[model samples]
Target: MAGDGVRGQETAVLAGGPADGMRITVADRPAVLQVTRPCVVEVPFGDVRVDGLYVYRRDLRVDEEPLRYGFDPASP
Candidate 1:
């Protein structure tokens, strides 16, 4: 994997670090990265293969509003 998080022929894997507080996995239907904790994730300019993926570009906002999604599952 490239240290710069850029694409080549190799791929980069994102997962929980040694601190044991993160769990990286893919979501279903409306595809989004579901991370267990608040951590900084960097992806290379490579292939992001999701089986049934539906994603928007970084510029797309929700309801034409600012990006205001949180990871807190308890919240409404």
Candidate 2:
């Protein structure tokens, strides 16, 4: 989840899909944001009552050039 200062805050993210090339927008007010990587994640074969799932990968991209901060699941 990505957010501003404090322990609890709102977050948002832009997610993408694998085969279908679908995009998901995550906006959680007063909560946390979750972005699921399509290729690395395992989606259920059938209709599942879950948003999405991602496999923990060490090679995950954290930040882009000029951006000091990086994307770390352990952080926030």
Best by lDDT: 2
Cα RMSD to native, each candidate?
Answer: 16.6, 10.1
Q: Write the per-residue lDDT of candidate 2 for residues 1-76, one digit (tens) a residue.
A: 3565333322223332221222222222222223454343376667544444432222225332211212334532
Alpha carbon lDDT of each predicted model: 0.29, 0.31
User: Model 2 segments beyond 4 Å from truth?
Assistant: 1-28, 40-72
The number of the candidate with the highest TM-score is: 2
TM-score of every prediction relative to native: 0.17, 0.21
As a whole number from 0 to 100, the lDDT of residue 5 in candidate 2 is 38
Model 1 clashes, total count: 1
Q: On a 0 to 100 scale, what is the lDDT of residue 4 in model 1?
A: 59
Q: Clash number for every model?
A: 1, 0
Lowest-scoring 10 consecutive residues by lDDT in candidate 1? Answer: 51-60
